[model samples]
Target: MALLKRDFIPVSKQQNMKPLHYPDCIHLSERCGCDLLSISECKGESCSFCQSAAQQELSQREWLSILNTLGLEQQKKIAGKYYSGKMPWKSQQKKG
Candidate 1:
């Protein structure tokens, strides 16, 4: 399922211009519907939660949401190809 834009809370930047640090586990917590707060300190890398989220594929609805963020012309072009069955599939055979 695609998460709505409102699902994410707006993160504010600090006065020192340093970006807020997000725990590598936020994606895992997100699956459980946790409203995460911005953290200033993070545990070291090598987090399995982060790694899993990174490898997950976006759903069709999520892809549509992303396409909607593009300009109108670009959106039309992509949607055209998608609806016309011309969108490439990894295992599709190519003709000479």
Candidate 2:
């Protein structure tokens, strides 16, 4: 099941930048919290907790969808000097 934007409860970034502890992740529930802040990035393909990376892929897709909503100007401002109009993924697609 794909996660909708409604699945998340937006909290102030400053208030929860670093959580005191990581609660057990419950995928598809409203109680789901951001695990990125507390855990190290990993492939997670073999992690039982990630259900063979399904959770990882779902989270990535959700975040990327939100990012894609940004206009070129907004994206450029965030990307700073590296903000080429063309993304690396687009360039790679052209080469192949």
Model 2 / residue 24 / CA error / Å: 12
Measured by TM-score, the strongest candidate is 2
What would the per-residue lDDT of candidate 1 be over residues 1-96, giving only the tens digit for each residue?
Answer: 222222344345543333333443434343223333343333324433342243344443355456556786775677577656333321221320
State the TM-score for model 2: 0.33
How large is the C-alpha RMSD of every model relative to the true structure? 14.5, 14.9
Candidate 1 residues lying further than 4 Å off, grouped into runs, are 1-58, 85-96
lDDT measured at residue 87 in model 2 versus the true structure, 0 to 100: 54
For every model shown, what is its TM-score relative to the native structure? 0.25, 0.33
- Report the backbone clash tally of model 1: 0
